[model samples]
Target: MPYIPTRYFCLIAALVTLAIAVSARFATNDYFFFAGYVVLQYVVMATAWNILGGYTGYVNFGTAGFFAIGAYSAVVMHKLFEPPLVVSIAVGGVMSGLVGLGMGYLTLRLRGVFFAIATLALAIVLQTLITNWDFVGGSRGVYIIRPANGPFGHPYIQYLFLTMLVLSTIAVCIARAIEHSKLGYGLATIRDDELAAEAAGVPTLKLKLIATVLSGALMGMAGAPLPYYVTYLDPSSGFNLAFAVNSIAMPLIGGTSSWLGPVIGALLLATIQQIATVTISSALNLLIVGVIMVGFVVAAPNGIVGLFERGVRARRRPAKKEAA
Candidate 1:
């Protein structure tokens, strides 16, 4: 047998931890299960946003566009074909990816705030269109009447928790792959200097499009089951600013340089919000996130990961001096 690296061991340990957590949720009450599901969903969406916003330095304000597309996709599939839950999620992801690719192709030419504004405009337009569309429920909303018993039993929370868990895991894997691949380097170059990156033979437009498609697909997956979870879907709720803000804020606060950044930020922020909701108004959660985002931007622009790295280096300094 060959020796496994410490990193591989750590990875195995993390997977085990995740499995244990999922099992624990099954043994817990519905409220705990739902809370876990929401946090995991946030992790998925935030990680998806990080692909473009963090890696490519593109502030996409149209995450809600993909999210809405996904919810609608799921609703349409469930209403028309009566597909399985997994199929609905897949449909949402595919539809959102196609839309994202198109939007990327159109707006990748724009730079800085212009690109951001273009995405925001796209989101607004999509919201309006959905609001008028009645097939999947117009401005009123769509109600998803879940089955009493399915593959996962009568407990909706368990199924939602598992679904979100899988989605979040997939989101993390995709982010890690991009961060460690040539695409990641290209994105970093594009982020740092698009003109220089283009001069260096990086296909800026293609890379941006790929990133957008992937980001949108993952976001769509996160949103696909949302209608079932809430038992209702409305244009206003589906295309909310909180989705965009949380997706961006998590990466920024966690340290966008690595895949772990958005994951860490999402977990921390979601946990905080969940706890606060018990004692304070749920509406104040956004206020908390906004305050933290502003503070992080001014105090620790690199985020929690950056701070951790600095602390690690500081600890190692004394050991290096002793060895010398």
Candidate 2:
């Protein structure tokens, strides 16, 4: 069969997804909608995180900080003057993108673990600041009342799921576009060796800033909807380290090399975690992720994608020998 055009594939996928989201309301219960929303939210988070972490080789432990910035920004907006979800999400993205840009300006030059440490410090700082900001309830947290009438006629949770699905689609589109662009080549060079990339005129700092802003913005957008989903926002929950851990783990375990890796990783890891949470205990979810991450790192260092590529090449070698 002829290769399908990327745009056509993406368009068809989006339409199919829209169909599912609409049909899902009739077919599935609210619990599935709620759970699916969580999974899709991580799909956006993992994809966004990988733009910087996987592409540029800068591992950010501040995923929670950017995510909370989005959530808290929404809370502040709601209290001051409630806006629609889309508007609030945009505001959140801007807030987190600015933070990322500032952080990149100061610390992007610090290579490797040092840069990661800086991001960790930033997360801690943001968490502390939010904990003291009483307007948004600070450590006490704030409660959000979802609008009785959602954008469409559907229940609010279902609407939230659809919104996440759209956001996840948008994020994946951006990542795939970037992966196939010259920018991706620059990022790969930087990831492999910043010195060589810089020597080759890759505009290292500028590229890093772009990756940081895009990654943080997408992360913020993902977190923006959480206020409606959770109904309560606290620094403790908003700044939970699980965001950082899972975002990092999902991308790593899926394969950090391409756009689809994070999505695959998120779906697999999230589905398994969801199952474990139901049959096992919710507390064991993170432990399972940890064990799986360690195993992937040791056994398949390049992730599921790497293993897949290896398998394909292994099969190809036998075919080549037969042809010869």
Best by lDDT: 2
Worst 10 residues of 1 by lDDT: 1-10
**Model 1: per-residue lDDT, tens digit, 1-324?**
254444564476469658856576557467877788888988998899989999999999998889889988999998897788899899999999999998999998999899999999999999999999999899999999876555756476677777787788778877887777799999999999999999999999999999999999998989898888888889999998988888889889999988889999999999898888878878998999999999999988999999898888999999999999
> Listing every candidate in turn, what is its Cα RMSD in Å to the true structure after a full C-alpha superposition?
2.8, 1.5
**Distance from true location, Cα of 109 in model 1, Å:** 0.7
- Mark the 10 consecutive residues where model 2 has the least summed lDDT: 1-10
**What residue runs in model 2 are displaced by over 4 Å at the alpha carbon?**
1-6
Clashing pairs for predicted structure model 1, backbone only: none
lDDT of 1 at 162: 77
TM-score of each: 0.93, 0.97
lDDT of 2 by residue, 1-324 (tens): 255556876797689788877788685578888788888999999999999999989999999999999999999999988999999999999999999999999999899999999999999999999999999998999999998657888788888989999999989988987887799999899999988998999999999999999999999999999999999989999999888899999999999998879999999988888888888888987898899999998999999998999999999999999999
Q: How well does candidate 2 score on lDDT at residue 122?
A: 97
